[model samples]
Target: MRITNNMMTTASVRNINKNMERLSKAQEQVSTQSKIQQPSDDPVVASRAIRYRSYVARVEQYQKNVDNVTSWQEVTDSALSDLSDVMQQLKELVVQGSSDTLSDSDLAAIKEDVTQLQQTAIDTLNTSYGGRYVFGGYATDEEPYSMDADNNVLFKGQLISDFNDNGDEQAIKANIGYGTSVTVNVEGQDVTGMGSGNLFDTFAKVLDGLDSGDVSELSDTLDAIESNTDTILAAQADLGARMNYVSMVGKRLDNDYTTYKELMSNNEDVDMAEASAESATASTVYEASLSVGVKVMSKSLLDYLA
Candidate 1:
């Protein structure tokens, strides 16, 4: 069988084309720093990379939720701390006001301090952070308290506010009690029991008695103020526990985020050493193919005569 010039030329052209294709593919792989440039290169690895990316995205979203939760916890803690301090000051005022030996003038002087303490409580309740009322829950734009002309307190917002971390309520545990679900803002009256004649209720009465010169009410005022202090302390304790819970959840979220990042790296990140080896192998194969093609093409028409 004779190998004609036209056939030799065609064969050489085919080998050169094949080598060029290999060279292009190797260069692409080197530039991309990936063994799998396209899905066709390694369909399984590509699919795994997709899943890993999705996992990383979800982890990032959870991280954002953790941030919000942490912020909420901080606000809760601040409010509770302020409330505790207010209770202590009110207790002192009640003690000073209870002295029967003091003149009406002395009691009247102490009443001013009580009024200031009450005003401070109001201010703390209406506290805002980042332009939003911290205790307002979802009513971020609204103040949680409003004072009447008669010095009475009214809750201006909801009792319970909703805070969700990661779109999953289970991820968050802001609410601690098992009572009626309050609105966005927990009313001072609701927590301290104003109508039920709790400690806070007695404190209000004591403040009124100071102006009325009702010396007999001073003893009861002291009792109520002390009791109310205890109640506020308990609520503050609950807030502290909730803060701890948020901290724990945040830690778990951070660990999960780290794990997800590592998984994503394993799935999609290139192995530099392995990629370089593969590129070198591809180069050698491509060069060998070119050499073989050149030798075959050099035979020419004389080789056919022999």
Candidate 2:
């Protein structure tokens, strides 16, 4: 078939348009730093980016939970440490008051000191973090430890020693990872143990022994005080273990966050160097096609004027 000027011009114009489209696409990729402008450009890359972004979002939420739980544990640990210190003072008072060489007034003074220290311990057990009591189990809104009219220590309105006798104490758990959690609250019963009416009751006996000037009874109550200290230490140890585990989970989550973010970037981001080269190549082809299109249109105004 014979080639006509009109047909050549049409074909040249069509080819130039296609080249211009390619140039625009390459330039857009370079400028936007993305492999595709829309999902329709590469469905697989778009889908993978979505999934990876979702994974990153979930990891972020897990990280937030970890941070919150870590803070809770830290506050709880600090409170327990304070209580231990108070107990140490109580022990010193008991040791001093147990001696028979002291006068009645001296014994009375020691008894007063012990009473103040016991109240301090109770206040420590009622410690709150973020306006929620750390030792109240699920009853975080209320103070866990209190003294009744009879000097009996009550945990959430129940006798401290009898609080968990029926095994009804609930733990406060926090999710640090997928399907993984750690207990954050140290229960009041765990702090005082199940001996007699609890630590405060033992303190009451110590006070009574002091009041009546009975050195033997005051000396015997030292064992109960020691037991209370042991129980508090055990609770602290358990809390420490949970804190360590949460730290590990947090580290893993940080790794996961970085991994997911990199994966998403790889799926959607364009290589700037490659895209720039492709854009240059496409621009060269488009310009060449445009020049050829102009030449193909042989019948111009110049021909008419001639």
Candidate 3:
């Protein structure tokens, strides 16, 4: 086989160009800190990277949802605690008011205190966080309670509670005994189970009893009030349990976040140590190719004849 000088030179230049290209690619991989710089580098890795990016994005969105729900849950928990405190104080005042030794002035003072407690409870029911009502469920933009002309309380919100998980309408149970959509907004008309009197109606009667200086009429009503407090405590206990469950879920979410991040790193993030080793190996191969090309090109047809 006869080899020409032009062909030999062209082949040597091509080999050097190929080596330079491989070296440039290695440098780019190091600079970018990515093994799969382009789809041609490793199509499977590139596809995996795309899928990983989507998974990370979805995990981030889930974290955001968890943040919003957990924050609102905190507000609801605080409101429930405040309501319990107010109920406790009101119970004490009712006890004092129940005493036969109490005078008209004493009864009036207790009524005033009870009114304040009722107002506080109303305020708690209407509690808002970031302009959204905590206990108002999906009707977060609206107030949950309102006062009538007779100074009696009326619940304006629906009994439907909506607690979603991860933006899906997964009705996470907030109460054990109560259904997920339990109507918590007990209207004056619907109160039952503690004898015929409702909370709002019974409380109104208590006010009248105070005005007429009739303390004895409140005995049965006080019993009903105790029962009402028990109901409130039951609901609160349920809320507390829900809060705890959410907290546990939040902890698990954090763990999941960590696990996903690590998995993503393994999937997409470059291993610097391995990349450096590859770059070094490429450098050696490229340098060896250049040396071989120089040697081959330096030997011409005229030199062979000599």
Candidate 4:
């Protein structure tokens, strides 16, 4: 090999460029706080980072669903609690109205109170959360119960049996974890007995019985009111169970999110201490390479020949 000045200059320049590239890479890692800015930097790490990020995203969505489920269940539980209180008040009114010595004016006042309590029960059954009826089943847009011109309680929403034919009473479910779901709604019929002559009808009957001083009908309504109170308690229990399940799932999701985030950081995040050391070393090497290249390239062919 002649070992010409031209060849020496070319080789030195190439070496300097290689050193600059290494320095640039180190600087990028330190500046961005990332090991692999692009997939080409480290394909395996990049792929794993992608997967970990996707897992974290999914966990986040599950957390949101769990939150929504919790909110719905809380609303349902509150409504049931209110209904229980209303039923208790109605029971007291029924007992007073059943007395034999009550006058026509006294019976009228009792009827008025019963009517108000019935409306309260309807309002409780038609409770809404986030602008959607909690007991409307799938018909979240409409009220679950309403009173007719004849003071009869009607089921405005779909019943469980009606779900087969475009019914809105289907249970509301949420995905709280991988391949796991929980129902967050209590159907109106289940809570209010809307399907089998309803709690509201019982209230109306009590009101009419009180108005006419019909002690027999009022006594029967008292029994029916007790049954309705039991139904509300049952629905509250179901909501409580669902809420517990949601809470458990939420805790697991939080832990999973933490794990996924740690994995993602390991796959793509740069170690600041290591990156800083490497960047400093690369900078020194690049500077040395540039000095060497300048010295080599400044020498002419004549000087080499001499």
Best by lDDT: 2
Q: How well does each candidate superpose onto the true structure, as a TM-score?
A: 0.75, 0.88, 0.78, 0.90
Better of 1 and 2 by TM-score: 2
lDDT of 2 by residue, 134-248 (tens): 8888899999889899887788898766665476758988777889988878887788776574778788888899899888888888888888888888999999999999999
> For candidate 1, what is the TM-score?
0.75
Tens-place lDDT digits, model 1, residues 1-306: 996767877987887788778778767767876657788888888998888788777667655655665675576557767877887877777677766777878887888887787778778877775677765445568876666676566555222222112232212223322221112233344335434455435657878888776767766676666676677677667656655765666677677778878877776667777767767877888788788878877775577789
Clashes of each: 9, 0, 0, 1
Candidates, ranked, lDDT:
2, 4, 1, 3
- RMSD, model 2, all Cα superposed? 2.6
Off by over 4 Å in 1: 1-30, 100-106, 129-132, 157-190, 198-203, 213-216, 287-306
User: Model 1 clash pairs?
Assistant: 158-183, 158-184, 158-185, 159-183, 159-184, 159-185, 160-182, 160-183, 160-184
Model 4 segments more than 4 A misplaced: 157-169, 194-197, 301-306
Residue 286 of model 3: what lDDT? 83
Clashing pairs in 4: 138-168
> Least lDDT summed over 10 consecutive residues: which range in candidate 3?
184-193
Cα distance off (Å), candidate 4, residue 290: 1.7
Quote model 4's TM-score.
Answer: 0.90
Off by over 4 Å in 2: 2-9, 162-165, 195-197, 286-301, 304-306
Q: Could you tell me the lDDT of residue 159 within candidate 2? A: 78
